[model samples]
Target: MTNTKKETRTVNIDIRKDLFGANENAAALNAETFKKHGIVAIDIMGSVGTGKTQLIETLCDHLRDKYRILMLAGDLATTIDADRVASHGVDTVQINTGTACHLDARMVRVALQNVNLADYQVIFIENVGNLICPAGYSLGVDRKLVVVSITEGPYMIRKHPLTIKHADMVIINKIDLVEALEFDIDALEADIREVDAAIPVLRVSSKTGEGIDQLIKVLNL
Candidate 1:
C-alpha cells in the first residue's frame, strides 16, 4: 500500500507587520526607561524645511533654565540640526539614520547609550524630516508634535491625513508670513480639523516667537 503524504503550503510572512510590531514593543520599553528616569520626552516631526529644528531651538531656549534638557536630532547624514541645538547649550545626541526616514525607538535608545538619562529632566527627539515615515514610528515620547508650515503649501494637510491623525498636536508654523504669502491660516487649520477634530492646533512663528508661549503652555513645559 502506497501512502501519500499530506501537502503543505508555504506561508507568507508580512515583514512590515513584524517590523511595526517590534517597533511598538521597543517603544514601550523606551517609555518605561524614560519614566524610570523621570524624564519628559518630546518627539518633533515634520517636513525637511518645516522649521522643526528652529521650533526645537525656541523650546530649548525657553525651557533650558527651568529644566535640564537633552536634544536628540535625527537626520539622514549631517549633524546640522544637532549642532544647531547644541550651540544653544542643550546637550545633544545626533542619530544619523543613514537611509531611514524616521527615528525608531531602537535608534533613540541606542543613541542614549552609555549616557546618564537621569541627568536630563526633558528630552527632545527631532525625527528625520518626513511626514509619512515618522508617523508610523513611536519613540516613546510624551507627545508627538508635527510642524506644518505655510511654506509647504496648503495641500500638505489634505495630502497627508495619516500624519495629522497620528500627531498629538498640529503646529501651523510660519504664520507670521500668512499675509505676505496670502496663505489662509484658517483654511490650513480647517484641513487639520477635518483630519483630527479634537487635535490641538497652534500657529507659531519659531523665528519671531509668535505663539511660542501658547505652544509652551500647551506642552506644559
Candidate 2:
C-alpha cells in the first residue's frame, strides 16, 4: 500500500475584515483611555481644502482659556496643519500617514503613547484629508465632525452621504464666501438633512469667527 501525503492549502484571509476588526478593538481601548483621563476627543474629518485646520485653530482659540487642548493633525506628509495649530498656542502632534488615506485607531493610540493624556482636557484629531476613508475608521473620539465647505462645490454633500451619516455633527464651513460663490447654503443644508435629519448641522466661517461661539456652546465647551 502506498501512503499518500496529505496536501496542505493556504486559506485566503480577508485583510479588510481583519483590519477593521483590529481597528475596532484598538478604538475601544482608546475610548477607555480617553474616558479614564476625562478627555473629550473629537475627530475632525473632511476633504482637502475644506478648512479643517482653520476650524481647529478657531476652536482652540475659543477654548484654550477654559481647557487644555491638544491637536493631532494627520496628513500624507508635512506638519503644516499641526504647525498652524501650534502657532495658535495649542499643543499639537503631527501624524504623517505616508501612503495611508486615513488616520486609524492604532495610529492615534501610538501617537499619544509618548504624551501624557492627563495634561489634556480635549483632543482634536484632524484626520487625513479625505471624506471617504476617514469616515470608515474610528479614532476613538467622543464626536466626529465633518466640515463641508462651499468651496468644494454643491455635489459634496450628495456625493459623500456616508461621511455625513457617520458624523455626529456637520459643519458647513466657509459660509462667508457663500454669496461670492453663488452657492445655495440652504440647499446644501437641505441635502445634509436628507442624509441624517437628526444630525446637528451648523454653519460656520472659521475665517470671520462667525458661528464659532455657537459651535462652542453646542459642544458644551
Candidate 3:
C-alpha cells in the first residue's frame, strides 16, 4: 500500500571553487596584514631536492645585514628546512603540515599569530615541496618563486606548465652542475617561455653562490 514516491533531492557542490574562494579570502587578509607591517613576503615553491632550502639560506646570508629576515618552512612532517635556514642566524618558524600537501592561507595566518611581524622586514615562506598543490593556494606573498634544478631532468618544465604560469620568477637552480650533467639549460628556458612568455627566468647555483647576486637584484631584495 506504500505507493507514495520518495522525495528526490540533489545538491551540487563546486568544491574547487568553494575551496579556492575561501583560501582567496584568507589570502586577502594575509596580504593586508603583511602590507600593514611593511613586510616583503616571498613564497618559494618547488618539488623535493630542488634546492629551495639552500636558496633561502643563501638569500638570508646575503640580505641579513640589510634587512631583518624571517623564514617560514612548510613541510609534511619535518623541520629540516627551518633548521637549515636557522643555522644562518635567521629566525624561523617551522610549519609541519602533517598530511596536507600544501600550505594554505589559514595556516600561514596561524603560524604568524605570535610572530612579531614588525621585527622583520623580509619573510620567506618555503612552501611544501610540491609542484601541483602549492600553486593552487596563495599565502599572500609579494612574489612566488618556483625553483627547478638542472638535476631534476629536462621534462619538469614541460610537465608543469601551470606551476610556471603561476610563478613570479622561475629559478633554474644548481647551474654549477650543468657541465657535469650535460643538461640543456636553453631548452628548459624555452619550455618555460612557452608556458609564460614574459616570466623572468634566472639561472642559479646556490651551493656555489653563482647567480645569487643576480637573483637578489631581480628580486629587488
Candidate 4:
C-alpha cells in the first residue's frame, strides 16, 4: 500500500488600493480645486473648428454681466487660441501641451496659479479641440459641454460616443450654416440621443447669436 500525500498550494495575495477611482476621482479632485477658489469651472470639448472658441466668446458676451469670466486654452502648441479668446476682454491662460493630446488634472492645477479663480465666478478650460482625448482627462469643471457644429456633419455625435457619454450638456453650434451646408438637425439630435438619451442639447449659431438665449438659460444666467 502506497501512502499518498495531499499537496496544499498557497496563492500569494496582494492588496493595493487605488488612490483615486478612475476618471470620476480625477474629476472630484478637480472639483475640490475649483471649490477652494469659489470658481465655477466649465470644460469645453469639441472637434477642430467646431465653433468652440466662438461659443466661449458668445458666452462671455452674454454672461459677463452676471459672472466674472476667465479662460484656460489648451492646444498642442501655440498661444493663438489664448490670444483669440483674450480679445474678449477676459483673462486667458494658454496651456501648450506639446506632445500630449489632452488637458489632465495637473495641467488644471498649474493653470490656476496664473489666473485668480477667486476674481471670477467662472473659469472655462477650453480643452484641446479634440473629441477623443479630452474625454479621458478631468479638468475639475462644474460642467462639461461638448460642442458639435453643423459643419462637422451630423454623424459626429454617433461617432464620438465617449465624448457624449461624459458630457453634462451638448451644444450643436453653427446652426446658421445648416441651411448653407444642408445639415439635418433632426438626425444630429437623434445621433446624440443614441449616445445619451437625457443630455441637454442646445442648438446655437455663435455667428448669428441664434439659440444663445437658450444656452444662457441652461447656464442659469
Among the numbered candidates, top lDDT falls to 2
Instruction: Tell me the whole-model lDDT of each prediction, alpha carbons only.
Output: 0.93, 0.95, 0.94, 0.84
**Per-residue lDDT of model 4, residues 36-146, tens digit only:** 878878899999999888989888888777888888999999898889878888889998989878888777777776665568888888999888988867667889999
Query: Which pairs of residues clash in candidate 3, taking residues 3 or more apart in a chain or in different chains?
Result: none
lDDT score of residue 79 within candidate 1: 93
On a 0 to 1 TM-score scale, where does candidate 2 land against the true structure? 0.96
lDDT tens per residue, model 1, 22-80 = 99999999999999999999999999899999999999899999999999999999899
Better of 1 and 4 by TM-score: 1
> Tens digit of lDDT per residue, candidate 3, span 1-221?
88989999999999999999999999999999999999999999999899999999999989999999999999999888999999999999999999998899999999999999999999999999988889989888999999999988999978888888788999999999999999999999999999999999999999999999999999998
In order of listing, the candidates' clash counts read: 0, 0, 0, 0
Q: Which residue pairs in model 2 clash with each other?
A: none
**Which runs of model 1 end up more than 4 angstroms from their true locations?**
1-9
Clash tally for model 3: 0
Could you tell me which 10 consecutive residues in candidate 4 have the lowest summed lDDT? 13-22
Model 4 CA lDDT for position 12: 66
Q: Rank by TM-score, descending?
A: 1, 2, 3, 4
- Indicate the residue-level lDDT of 217 in model 4: 87
Which portions of model 2 show Cα errors greater than 4 Å?
2-12
- The TM-score values for the models, in the order shown, are 0.96, 0.96, 0.95, 0.87
lDDT of 2 by residue, 96-170 (tens): 999999999999999999999989999999999999999889888999999999999999889989999889999
